[model samples]
Target: MSKADEKYLDIVENILNNGYYDNNRTGIETYKLPHQIMQFDLSKEFPILTTKFVAFKTAVKELLWIYKDQSNDVRKLQAQNVKIWDEWMLEDGTIGKAYGYQVAKFKQIDNLINTLKTDPQSRRMIISLWNIADLKDMSLTPCCYETLWDVENDRLNCMLVQRSGDIPLGVPFNMCQYAVLVHLIAKVTGFKPGLFTHVINNAHIYKNQIEGMKLQLKRRKQAYEAPTLWINPEIKNFYDFTPNDIKLIDYKHHEKIKMEVAV
Candidate 1:
């Protein structure tokens, strides 16, 4: 089994058997421990969940739209039939200061890329999108609020900090999304992608998702090996990458496990 499945199953089991009964925005529920972190060494393999079909291409497009284009337009995503952010778009079709605004304001994306190229040893490499001043203007705040980057032995590592996560809905997508981001950045920055550590401050499974969680837990032991991702060799520029340029090779897995999307 891949480390991702093991970690996910462990969380589900803990929630089902030992999680405390509690009430939150998702109503009365048993929640797994929050602030529970899982780390996967990307050097071994990519961290996508083989037990379920993650929208890997869609996730890549959205990530690229945010950091590469530095855009906040929902129509840009809608043009590609990706409506993940449609719910959060304002009437004017922008998402306020949440995503690309933060990228542009601090020049965070370019700075990180430049630092990775010139000073890979720098410990201060970070990109933050959760601007407090811009929160009130946003329909929804950023969940994966921050990323801290590190480098070792010419391999790039990333630590993603999410302030909140709806395990059945959002966590899986975010995990794969950022992991791919690490790989993309590594390639553009002239290093191999390494570890991806996800830290969730509020990693809770909703009450409606209990059965799905239980179902996923049953297939945990049957999960396949992590898949290897391939990016086009000739694409040197980060902005030049499109969905067609990113590919997942030898992605073996059992049947996909479907779950409810928490609102």
Candidate 2:
């Protein structure tokens, strides 16, 4: 079984069995568990679930749209055939002062790369998209907002702190994309990819998505091994990377378990 699935399924099982039932802004209530964490060694294996299909390319594209392109325009993603953000897109064709907007506004990515090269030991290396002042203008608050970076023994490590996670639909993508982000940053900064830790302050399964989660759990015993992440070594600069530059080789997994997003 894929190690990612092993850990992920455990969380799903626990949530269904013991999560706190509650109502939130979405109106559709959820079974939520607080402070759920998943840790993986990026040097050992790529952490993507093989128990069900995950849209690796689409996930990476949204990632690039944020940190690399520094864009909050939903039309930009739509141009690339990614409609994941369509639900929250505002009238001006952008998410408005969210995600990439905050990253660019604070010059977070540029400063992060520069700092990583000059001082690998700096403890202040953080990329945060949770701008309190900009929240009111945002179409939707950033869920997986902050990322803190560290370096140890020539390995680059990261901790992703998500304020809230919709386990069935969003969490899987969040885990994989951030892990790839760590690799991309490490490759550009001249270091090996080390630990990738995911922290979800409120991890929840929507009431309507419970059946999908239950079906995914049934495939746990048949999950495949983690896939090998292939990156184009020729591209040294992070800005040169495209969706095609990175890929998953030999990724075997079960059929897609369709789930709905609670808007």
Candidate 3:
């Protein structure tokens, strides 16, 4: 079984057996756990779940829309046929002062990249999207809101902080995309991909997703090996990457496990 699947399933099992049931703002009750973490070494293998198929290309598109394009327009994602954010898209044709808006508003990606290139050892390399002053303007507040970056021995590392995570539906997508982000940034900055760490303050599974989550749990014993991530060798610039340029080789997984979004 892939290490990613092992760690993810462990969390799922933990929540199912030990989590506290609680009501939240989304109007759905959840089985909640706190302070859950997952870490991966990119050099060993790309961390993507093997127990169920993750929409890797779709995740990449969403990541680019937020970090690379630095856009708040849902239209741009719709242009690529990605609709994950359709639920939160506002009538103004954007997601308000959330996500890409925050990135563009502060030019956070540019600043981080420049810092990695010019001041590799700087302790201030961070990108944050949780803008307190603009939360009221956002259609949805950012969940995976901050990223702290570091460089050592020509290797790039990242730590992602998420305020809340929808374990069954959202965490899988978030995990793979951020790992991809680490690789993309490492390539652009002329460093080897090192480690990617994810921390979720509140990780929960909605009541409606319980059955599907249990179905996935049953497939744990059959999980396949980790897949290799292939990035186009010629693309040194992060902005030059297209979905075609990033792919998984031999990504064998059980099947798609559908679950409704709580939002």
Candidate 4:
């Protein structure tokens, strides 16, 4: 089994068995646990779940829409046939000042790339989407926010701090995509992919998703080996990447687990 599956499954099992049942702002109750973490060495394996299928291409499209395009417009994602954010899109055709909007506001991606290129030893390399002043304007606040970057011995590492994570649906997508982000940024900045650390402050499973989560847990013992991530070697610029340029080689999983979004 992949190391990701081992770690991820452990977390899921922990939440299901010992989590606190409580009501939340979403009007749906949840089985939640606090301060859960997962770390991975990207050089060893790609951090994607093999117990159940994850929509890798769709995740990449959303990541690109945010970091590459720096857009808050849901229309751009819809243009690519990605509809994950359709529920949160406001009447104005945007997700407000939530994600890509904050990136554009401070040119965060540009600054991070520039710093990675010029000052590899700097300790201040960071990109954050949690804009305090714009919180009220956002349709939904950023969950997987704040990324801290590091460089060591020609390798790049990233740490993602997520304020809230829906374990069944959101966490898997977030894990794979952020690892891909590290690979993309490392390639553009001329470094090897190193480590990825994910920290979730409140990791929860919505009541509606419990059955789906249980079905996934049943396949835990049959998890397959980790797949290799393929990025186009010829692409030197981050913005040049598309869904075709990235792929998962030999990704094996049981099947898709259907779960409803709490929103």
> What is candidate 1's lDDT per residue for 1-263, written digit by digit as tens?
77887886676677677666678654546475678688988889787787777778888888888888888889999999999987778989988877877898888988999998888889999999888888998777888889999999988889999998777678887888888899889988889989899998877887778887777777777789888888899999888989899889988766656765554
Looking at model 4, residue 38 earns an lDDT score of 98
The best candidate by TM-score is: 2
* Predicted model with the maximum lDDT: 2
Candidate 4 worst ten-residue window by lDDT? 62-71
Task: Give the C-alpha lDDT of model 2.
Answer: 0.95
Candidate 2 lDDT by residue in tens digits, 88-207: 998999999999999889999889999999998999999999988999999999999999999998999999999999999999999999999999999999999999999999999999
Query: Ten-residue segment with the worst summed lDDT in candidate 3?
Result: 236-245
lDDT of 3 at 133: 100
Q: Tell me each candidate's TM-score.
A: 0.93, 0.99, 0.98, 0.98
- Poorly placed runs, candidate 2 (over 4 Å): none
At residue 161, candidate 1 shows an lDDT of 98
Residue pairs with backbone overlap in model 4: none
Tell me the alpha-carbon RMSD of every candidate.
1.7, 0.6, 0.8, 0.8
